[model samples]
Target: MISVRVNGQRFQVRAASIVIHDGHVLLHRAADDDYWSLPGGRVEIGEAASATVVREMKEELGEAVTCGPLVHVVENFFDIKGEPNHEIGFYFQVALSEGSPLVDKARSYSGLESDLRLMFQWHALLDLGSIDLRPAFLRNTLSTIPLVFSHVVHPGADDV
Candidate 1:
């Protein structure tokens, strides 16, 4: 991972998935945080964005996904705990086939990975706007998915 630090905060490259099933999307948020985001993680060295999404799905959801085309490329700039943070997120259209455990499980799941306990949740598209979905542009994009790959630039906190 090639991370740059600005005033003690790290900027990173991440990969996320737009896993929509039955009018709902799979979103993950840490138990300690109040915001929700896509189910993906940082991009490792030499790993393609699609591969990262697939790997993340397996690790986070315990299910396999067929990564589809690139949907959106988001340039997200925001502050975490008052520290400037930026991330380039590649969002792919990932599909979960029938019989996937995530498709029929409880709404909340907890797991211990990389020394952090993470929580994952599924939210209906209709309820997205009521929550704090990071990158802020994500909520709007989800409502009207773009036909072609588009870039979303969120400049600092005001943009959300």
Candidate 2:
């Protein structure tokens, strides 16, 4: 994991997948979290950000994905466990390979990675604002993913 603690603040580089189907987007969250986020994980040292998205999908969901173009580059500042945190996120369009059980959009799914339990769901893009999706800007931006790349900076809890 490309994560470090400096001056009591956590910094990490993350790569996430954005998978849309039938006007819905795939999202997931850890068992203990009240909000949902994209399906990917921390970028490992020496690994490309795009590769991290593919690897994380396989590791976390037991599903293979085809990584697509980079959609957004985000500088997100937030807090976790009373500690300040900063994250550099690479969001990429991705598609599940054929025969993926996770393709079902009618219901939610669950998986376990190591000791962490994860819940996966598909949420309608039109109703995104009604749910708790962190990096909060995503509620408005995801509905119209730009054709070209985009960069965003979310100040912190108060604004994002």
Candidate 3:
């Protein structure tokens, strides 16, 4: 959870999960926020990106996940609470561990993480264009997901 300051802005390294099932994708938004995005958190020092996804899932979803191959590598520059922020994100394809009820249900559900009060939900993949997913690039990329991993660069967020 280290934050580095670069030219008065903040930079971070994060890992995200792209969990899809039955034509839907799993997304989460903080309780006070208005947009949806992948579920994951910052990568801890010394932790592998893949492991970060696994740990974040357990913390945010209260479920175990098995991370598959990395699908997208993104360099995102955005602003949070008026502060410029940048993140190097690793998006990995993931799934609920075997026997998890979520795997069987494959429908939208909401829950508040006890500590953060973050709300996790499932959204139909077909409707992603209407949602506000940060890094913005994802809005288009998710529809025709590439079989091979891709590199993405989001110059910056317009909200700044």
- Steric overlap count per candidate: 0, 0, 0
lDDT of 3 at 90: 95
TM-score ranking from best candidate downward: 2, 1, 3
Q: Candidate 2 overall Cα lDDT vs. reference?
A: 0.89
Q: Candidate 1 residues 47-106, lDDT tens each?
A: 998999898878866778899999988888778888887788899989886777777535
What is the TM-score of candidate 1? 0.88
> Which has the higher TM-score value, candidate number 1 or candidate number 3?
1
Instruction: Enumerate residue pairs that collide in model 3.
Output: none
TM-scores of all candidate predictions against the true structure: 0.88, 0.93, 0.87
lDDT of 2 by residue, 17-56 (tens): 9998878999999999999998888999999999999898
Top candidate on lDDT is: 2
Off by over 4 Å in 3: 104-114, 145-147, 156-160
* lDDT for position 89 in model 2: 98
Better of 1 and 3 by lDDT: 3
List model 3 lDDT by residue over 38-77, tens digit each: 9888888999999999998887667889999999998887
